[model samples]
Target chain A: MKRYFQNKSLLNLVFTFLGGVLLLFIIAPLAGMYLNTSFNSVHNAVGSEEVQASVWLSLWTSMAGTILFSFFAIPLAYLLARKNFPFKSLVNGIVDIPIIIPHSAAGIAVLGIITRDSFLGRAGELFGIKFVGNPAGIILAMAFVSIPFLINAARDGFAAVPERLEKIALTLDASPTRVFFTISLPLAWRSILSGFILMWARGMSEFGAVIIIAYNPKTAPVLIFERFTSYGLKYSVPVAVVFVTVCLIIFVTLRLIKKKN
Target chain B: MLVVDNISLKAGNFELKNINFRVDKGDYFVILGISGVGKSLLLESIAGLTKISSGEIILRGRKISDEKIQRRNISIVYQDADLFPHLTVFENIAYPLHSRKEKNIKEKVLTAAEQTGIADKLERIPETLSGGEYQRVALARSLASGNDIFLLDEPLSSLDSKSKNELRVLLRKLNRNGITIIHVTHDYEEAVSLANKIGIMEKGEIVHVASPEEIFKHPKSEFVAQFIGIKNFLRGELKALRESDLKEFSIDGIKIFSLTDAGDGEAFLLIQPDEISISNSVESGSARNHFKGKITDIARAKIGIEVTVDIGCELISLISIDAMNSLELKIGKEVWINFKASSCKIYN
Candidate 1:
């Protein structure tokens, strides 16, 4: 067994086998789909009204959700990291609720609040802003399920900042608020940015909640689902492939930026 | 002047009670204590880092109990070299000055860096600096802010002996320049060497507070005597008592005298390690009490060598290196160990 294992020939054979298997997992499906796909079909998919609207809606809603979630999550994360409060564990548990619940159930739960009968919908009606089938509902759905990643990640980031640094800042005559901005936030920013990127990617990929509340606006995920249902695999696969590749590029770039940070 | 009047704080498992002391303008008050004795907590309480349960911290004639830490004008240098890693060495030292938006911040930072000998590492980040350099930057950052009342919590703890001595000298210089320093450390020698007033803390309370001379010469309690490493403590009854301001006593047929004016009751004799002497013969000298004992052990200490001579009933005397050599001392050698009555303290 030692002689067999020590054989360099056997090691090369193992590498060849493993590399082929890995390449099959990563590259085979994309190659198979693209081989089957035609330039004319790609053009048609790109030109379609529903596909274009779906792509635009996905962009706007995810961007808006990411921005809003980051704005709210950063401070709350800092608070959870740095301060002592009553019912802290309870607050932490509550913050983790969205991440724990199934995405479909999370979507359903959000749908329950934004539907016409709910309090938020009632409040929105007073302001002449509807939620159901609206872009706002799509954004609300994306933000609801995806925000926990940002919050939790940002919390870890903020928690990593040594409290001594903050106290030192305070001793330096920086006010508490000033200290947070100058010392705490900057120190915790790498984690916060990673959280932000995770949230953005999660928001962009949101399907269940958007389908539940704003299926009419048709984010890319719902559109892909609808196209698959109506026109079978042949018609839908190319669009799905295009949508995924675009998102993959974006998500990877975001991750790289997070890594750099 | 910084006056901590009866500060008592109970945080988690650690309790600090009745911590009363004062540091006048330009005074370097070093608090010495063991781990978990609330030395850092006390410093924090004074700095407004930890909230005081009940106390008045009057700094520079201002009662800053409820005041925010930023407004208190008390800077702290923690043990961990708590420099902001994101900020460069210059930026870290410049932090306080920048926060106040003070004019001449760059000049102040440069000056501080120069003083701490970290001027060349200004542009370099904190993580790049060595432990000694990091602490020097921390100290520079602390001092550059213009807060004369500096709360240094083991600033030299991270540094080696050489660095510690250099920083100690720098701290002494700082004090001489009218910076009132409250330096907290677990090192007894540092407190003895650097502090104008040393507060010996045990179990959160300052058990003894005195000048270095007074504390070393006459520690009031057993804990202090033990803490300060005074090795000549023995349980004894005052056999015969002298009623003068400086009294006398005896133990176990070995007559001894103490400066403490205690009655003929239970007393513990206290003597510094340096005060005990060993002689080959009964030499007539300034020392009052002489006891015949066998040399038990010899060990080298920082200041001098300690000679432990066993006087049958477990009485020990710690003598100097010169004294040890002068007597040509070795283990199991019978000798006359003389520790004067005036030198020994009887604490009741």
Candidate 2:
């Protein structure tokens, strides 16, 4: 018993030592930013209209982009999970291209189709909207860079659902569409939701793509970069601290909801 | 009634060749084969879950080969009891009714649950149920669909013996209620007990289809004879034919009589192990065939002892352990082996 306890403690110590390094590496900078910032500076940053607009824009546009893209992405994910066809592997590789490339390259790729002379841009002009310097451009860039996370996660989720369950549902007089909605979708909802959360978070933090596409209506990351470049670390620290705290709260709340479900 | 007319399919590299069979209304038809013989694939093709390469499947005289699965009113139960884990037992059973927008669903679900003897497990999820209860839920779900035909893909394979017997009783009860069942199994005992008609499949082809009694009594092929536990097969040629379907055959120059009247030609003779009886004395009542043989070997069987005797040719005979002890049977001891002429089957 003594030897067993000694060995367990030694093993625990080894794991704890390695895990503590990664924990401290992540926590120390965030804690230091929050603790070192004064209340007055934080109040000033929070009260600023520009900062508030940028933060709100970041939150809602990412949420909008995530919700909008899920309609197409979830169905594609389901097809990837269940079907076999020619060029399936090619399509799967194309879905992951955005995740592998740099965000600036991804932004440039989106700009090609949505430029003023392009068909999509001309189509948008019919609705009195332009993509080059608009919120639509920012939304497009965010979705392009963040969609692969949702697709990959949701595909894995759908794959984990047993094929027999769907077959049984079909045998039970359920149409193909009905079987998908009633059996496959509900069972795979948890993973899809997680993917949604991941895409939303990644979209909010997008800097390289949003900056290249639409810099006028600044997102939180662009605003932080602007402040840091113009007024150095002292002025930018409060905005960064406030943004991190709010995102942390939102992420924790969403996780708690997921756990309850 | 269902008719699978020359239905053929290719799944991966395995091909199901021109399979033809018909299930009468309210018949317990079992397709008996070993695993990997495309039995499940055949069931899936009939249910429209998988596509057949050619030919048509007719149901109630309608060509349903092109019909969607939802339009084909056939329910299926798998061996693993693939119940929805996210739904309660009652909910799973009622899923078909809800999907069809049928009224009085709650009562129908409850009646099905009661029929499968799982009324008490209505609120439980599948993970919490035992194997038998899980299978009962699957059975209840299929039963509640109100389909006239039920495709059972070895529904009793995964259950314990006690549960298997209970499910067998339930299956018979369901059959008596006028449900046409197409059951697939590899167990000969299950095929013999539950099936009125049995089709033997080998290598993705239906080798023979016959009544269970005929399959056991007179297997038409060497594969069927060996598969159904007929241990003794002998090569012979018919010498003469007598009245009342009696025929004489020679095996290794020894004459034997059989009840099947075949033409004078080479034939295969099959004798079931249990049909041959052993006695210490030569006296017999009505056994037409008898031989003085020596006990060559003895081994323990499930219900009795299996004694091997060399009556000019090797023959296996099953006798009760009580009989074994009384006869004091031992190796190299001379004994009498007797069986009726009707017990020997001939296939050419």
Candidate 3:
């Protein structure tokens, strides 16, 4: 080991040092946030009914949004990967628009379609559900802001699969639909699942969009903001710590499962 | 039986024009061409993977040009195998069965695996298999579909020589089991070994189609002759017509005889390297044509030595290394090259 490093040039040492600094820059803030909070505050925050409800709302609504949106997003991804049509690049650019634009602007875009006067809002009213200040509105806002991750990731996954494999499947008497579901989808599942986790996490942490669309049924991010404004950092820091800890545990477990498979 | 009738297709900037062919049932038809010559495109168009601009593909007496790929009951194996990475070998082979909703899936999959000698690796995935094993699994998958027509696009090109030989035997075995095959390959040896009928494609056109023996021995075009490794192409004009369908031609004032009944006009003559024999002495028997030339070049061929003799024009001959040693053949050495009249093929 000593000889290995001794053979390195000074330029290599400088590059290594810069990369180490970037790694530390990412880890330091999260480590500081977790270490500064006391265990008693984290425990008390977890036990609070309103905090528990907000965490539950964030978890289920984001999961619901990801699951519901995947049906459409995955097929669109397959089409983008396999087909050649007019305005294809425009459609691809439109998929990325949600990711690049501000979350507040995304929220307003969802608002225009779901407002009471619009046809979609009237349709929701016919189903006895109001979008303004409701869980439905929150789910819609979460899905709107986070769906591009799923689409782009799944599209890349499908693109990586060999076109000949799908053609071979079709020649083997499998229909195009069967070929997609059996061959393309299963091969691309790893990317699709990672996309699912990313979209779900992004929805869980969404603040500006959820605040604009629905504020009554407070998600974890909205509740944390409300606590910071109403009380001091003393009240908000515990909730933030609790939410971050839970997210860390869940994300690590998911990544471990992904690795095992 | 299958027929590709007057097929014309435009793919990007490449255009295949008026391609026509027929493959009888149980025939191992090989399309031989160099790369970028629309061989794979032709196979894909036949399997309905690529659309043809104007054509009718007939299979078993029915026109199938407009049919969907799934309804065509044709199976193709690509060069890379293209096996599904997510599935185990068993699942990959059994995939078509699931699509067909067939009964006895286990029995069918096992039969195909056993036939391809891959039954032991059924539980493994494609990523873990060797190149030969991956191709065997792909072949098993195609065979499991119970399709009669098998289209292979350079399937053995990626394997090592030992593996390629093994798969070649396996493909021959599959052909013996009553499967009509349309194989596309750039390797002349593969085409000669597997094909009963060979089609030579050049620049997106089927330039010549004939039996393997006829193609190698009597190429009708200069391209076919050169592509098949026939090194001696002498452009000559017909000078006389002898009895028993024999004709004489002269090239650069040197006369040659060919056993063809072609008319008295401009003609091209082709002679394969193996058809010529080299002798140290000028004593020749039944061979009708003989020329004394000095050895100009000698190179190591795949099987033996390739000797180029200059008899006004360069003529190549393949002789065994032992023969070379016995004759003590060397550069600037004078030797006699003898060939029969039937050996020289003439085309007008």
Candidate 4:
């Protein structure tokens, strides 16, 4: 037993040392950017209406996108977890396609579906809504790429719940919908909630897809990129720092809620 | 009455083909089979959790194969209990009633909890309960639904022996109260102890359905014969004696007499262990089959001591503890085992 403990500690030390390098590597860039930016610049950036609008847009649109897509995505995830049919694996692979392909390509795919000449674009035009250079397009782009995270995580969550529970619920005179809402959904809430957070966070940080579909909407990430390329590190660092702070605050708050649940 | 008429289901590589069975009202029907033979699949299909490829399920003359699970009015209990982890025992029991929009959910939950002997534990969650208690909560939930028919899928297999026995008694009590039950299990003794009728399943197909006595006494196939190899089971040839109904049964060169009409060919003979009596001193009594053999082994049984006597070929006798003690039976003790000719069963 002592020998095993000694060996385990040695292996643990090696693991900690090796894994710590990547951890430090992640910390270095963010710490360097944060430390280089002045609090006065950050405060000034927060005061700017463009910064405020962009930040608010990023947060709310991402949340809206996460919530709206969840209704359909969650059911799809549950179906993936429970039932078996022909091309089921193909369907699963299609869900993951958004995650693996380039974000810009996903943006192009979204643009194709919602372009002004397309059916949804013309349909939205009748309702005084435009896809190009619009928040709706931004949400579509964000949701397109980030939905895989929600779907995969929720699918795993639903899978982790015992199938027998649903079977028993059905036998207990609960309809399929009732079993899903009462038994499956609650049991898989943790994973689904975490997936919600991840999807929202991933949507908030989106740049490539959002830029392609709606560059004028000026999400925080787009503004950061524009400022960085046009001005330099000094002008963009403050915005970057503020955006990171807001993301972290929301991420940590959601994490805490998940923990409590 | 519930009838599964020629139902067939294809689930991946396993298939339940041409499955047909029926359970009368107020009867405890058990499907006895080994694991991975589609026993649970059969129950799931019956519960409408899976779609059947062919045939129909009839419940009281109503075709229910097309009905939804919520409308089927049959409840089921699983082996692992599968209680909602977040809900208390009371809430778990009340959940089904709530879904059905039943009036007096609290009263029904309390009644079901009382029936399963979990009235006090209603406030507790399933995670805090033992295996037996967890299963009781599941059973209580089913009872709370007020369903007359129940499908239990190895509900006692996951429990300890004590819990298994307790659940068996509870099941019997529920059946006596006019509830029809179709239970699945791999344990032969459990089926015999609880089932008024038994269906033997093999490789996703039901091989035979009969009463427990008939199943044990007249196993139809080699698989069942091996699966339920009761004590003192032997395969041999039968020879007609000059006497009226007596036949000479020879098992591996050892001769025994039994009343049979298996005609004179090869046959199987079974002597129920409980039917044999053992004693230290030989008494010439009414029992036609008697042998003086040394007690080779004496072992504990579920209800008594199982003694194996090497009477040429070995023969097992089940005797009570008092009988074992009074007879002073032990290893290497000389004893006489006696059983009536009617006690022996012979079949081809």
Q: Which model scores highest in lDDT? A: 3
Q: For candidate 4, give the lDDT.
A: 0.89
Superposed model 1: Cα runs more than 4 Å off: A1-53, A100-130, B230-348
Relative to the real complex, the DockQ score for model 3 comes to 0.63
Evaluate every candidate with DockQ and list the scores: 0.59, 0.54, 0.63, 0.54
Best by DockQ: 3
lDDT of 4 by residue, A1-261 (tens): 999999999999999999999999999999999988889999999999999999999998899999999999999999999989899999999999988999999899899989878999999999998888999899889999899999999999999999878877887878888899999999999999989999999998999999999888799999999999999989999999999999989888888877887
Residue A173 deviation, candidate 4, in Å? Answer: 1.8
List model 4's recovered fraction of native interface contacts, to 2 decimals: 0.87
Q: Compose the digit string of candidate 1's lDDT tens values, residues B53-123.
A: 89788877889988888889988888775888888888888888878789988889999988878889999
**Worst 10-residue lDDT window, candidate 4 chain B:** B260-269
User: Taking the tens digit of each residue's C-alpha lDDT, what string does model 4 give over B242-344?
Assistant: 8467888987768888886556877667788999998776768778888899988888987888999998888899989998877777899899989988888
lDDT string for model 3 (A1-32, tens) is 87777767666988899999999999898788
Candidate 4 docks at the CAPRI level of medium
Query: On residues B208-278, what C-alpha lDDT tens digit does candidate 3 reach at each position?
Result: 89877678767888888767785776666985664556778898878887777555787667788899999
Q: Which residue pairs in candidate 4 have backbone atoms (N, alpha carbon, C) closer than 3 angstroms, thus clashing?
A: none
Query: Candidate 2 regions off by >4 Å?
Result: A1-20, B230-316, B319-348
Instruction: Pick the winner on TM-score between candidates 1 and 4.
Output: 4
Higher-lDDT candidate of 1 and 4: 4
Candidate 2, residues B19-101, lDDT tens digits: the string is 99999999999999888999999999988889999999999999999888878889888998489989999999999999889
Instruction: Single out the weakest 10-residue window by summed lDDT for candidate 3 chain A.
Output: A2-11
